[model samples]
Target: MADAREPVVVIGLGRFGTALALELAERGHEVLAVDRSDARVQALSGQLTQVVAADSTDIDALRQLGVQDFYRAVVAIGSELEPSILTTSLLVELEIEDIWAKAVSDHHGRILRRIGAHHVVFPEHEMGERVAHLLSGQLLDYMPIDTDFALAKIRPPHSAVGVPLAESRLRSRHGVTAVAVKREDGSFTYAGQDTVLSHDDTILIVGREADIERLVTRS
Candidate 1:
């Protein structure tokens, strides 16, 4: 976990980078926003702690901006593979400790990891899959975990509502694990073996995609 008190540096001021920097600033974390373009740095100057116009791939520039002092850094260069990889490499060499990079493809992700990025994300692919799951109408919301499992928000089955979890046979029948239960009034309770389901309850489940599909289809 990132320490909120430490200043965070965000390299690149594209949509993802700008959004992340603004959100971190709003959460009370000091943020240093950097971009190669004047427009991007200027657009976010008033909202973040500070904004700098510089090329992140230049080691001297990073040092000049004191980027190495921050433990948390996000390389948000999208599509530009060369700059993104170079920035990640520079951060790693500086031993910044926590490096997160956005990658457009598996190869890009692999390169980032090989160069020591702490975390790599594919925002477009992830969002596309999440939207697909919601479009299926069976899932209220969904997030992918690895390639096999997911955390899914779904409506409790009509047959299972008003019944205790022990009697639901969800685990035995559908091979899914329930994580939490959300009530209509917005209160939440950890799902347990004896918890009773309500008509307005939502359940968060983790399971295999095939099994999750079967569970929802059966419900």
Candidate 2:
């Protein structure tokens, strides 16, 4: 198993890369931020374990900076296709166990995976989708667990209000499971079959993405 304390190397220093590196550092992970721009490196200096101005695509420079020693790497070079692919390939060649790459599109994502990136993220695209879902105003929050499944936070539907979950038949009716509920007290509690739901209560539901969407958009 990979140690959580293991140092991670992040390349690019762009908006996505900088945010990821800082978040990782905030979570107590040792991070090395690398970018070719001296200004970017200088801006992040003293904020991370290490920040260096170096071309990530250059294998010699990467080796000199001891990047091969890190077990994980995230290639976050957005808008630059060649550097992103080259950097990811070099990390794979360096035998990094975990490689996460940011892709601007499906083709770019395929290339990253083909070059041995263990994980690929589309931050811009995903955020757009999440924002579109939130625009409906039916859900307070939405998290996709996988391609087909999701968890959503929403107010109890009219049929579900003033009834216990067991009698509400929410699962049978809407094909969604209410896992937890947050009441007027601003505290969350586990919701069982006998838990009664009120109009003001917020419910955390889990189910197939289609089912959750149907439940929220239902009349």
Candidate 3:
């Protein structure tokens, strides 16, 4: 179910790379999935537009596969820093519109960025941070908008229940804005001055990271 217009090359056939390719294919993007293993290529044959058994680090092989014409190339060789780096460099040299690489460490991320990768992702580190936030109990979900800003889903504490948003003075006191509130009946309303917070209400707030954290931890 791929769209002919958005062609993408995914280099590497590890779980992460394969999952990404399949997801893109499902989203209607033409995907060429490359792997060094014949078995892997065979396994993904019907799942992708093209499943090729070739080393992504091989520039000649890449050109032969017409990788240069891909709208985006993902170098997702997990744990293999050398091949990952070399493949990233090759994709840049081929002038692929966008190059995304997976890095095992901060140092590796820096190297990939320096070599002209459009973006480098540290999946393991990011997953760990997300898990830590979930385990903190107060936050139902936490998403960092930037280094300083965040959006969070938090449950209102007992003291704040039955109070109008204006009376709570959350904006001035906690420096956070309650953008939405989920009611007991499963309906959601945009937070307004007249909106009354009730017990067990799930609220979505956006503000500075520190302020959001304070609001979540407020008693």
- Which candidate ranks first by TM-score, i.e. highest? 2
* Local distance difference test, candidate 1: 0.90
Q: Which residue pairs collide in model 3, if any?
A: 3-28
Q: Candidates ranked by TM-score, best first?
A: 2, 1, 3
TM-score of each: 0.93, 0.95, 0.86
Q: Clash pairs of candidate 1?
A: none
Please give the distance, in angstroms, between residue 104's alpha carbon in candidate 1 and its true position after superposition: 0.4
- Tens digits of per-residue lDDT for model 2, 137-184: 888998877778888889998889888899988889999999999998
Give one digit per residue, the lDDT tens place, for model 3 in 1-219: 324557889999898899899998898888899999999999999888789999888899999999987778898896999999999999999988788999989999999999999988877877787678779887889877666787888887565578888888788888988899998779777889888988878998899977877777775
**What lDDT score belongs to each candidate, Candidate 1 first?**
0.90, 0.91, 0.86
Mind giving the per-residue lDDT tens digits that candidate 1 earns over 165-194?
A: 889888887888887999887876799988
- Candidate 1 regions with alpha-carbon error over 4 angstroms: 1-4
What TM-score would candidate 1 get against the native? 0.93
The per-residue C-alpha lDDT of model 3 at residue 46 equals: 80
Per-residue lDDT for 115 in model 2? 84
Model 2 spans > 4 angstroms off: none
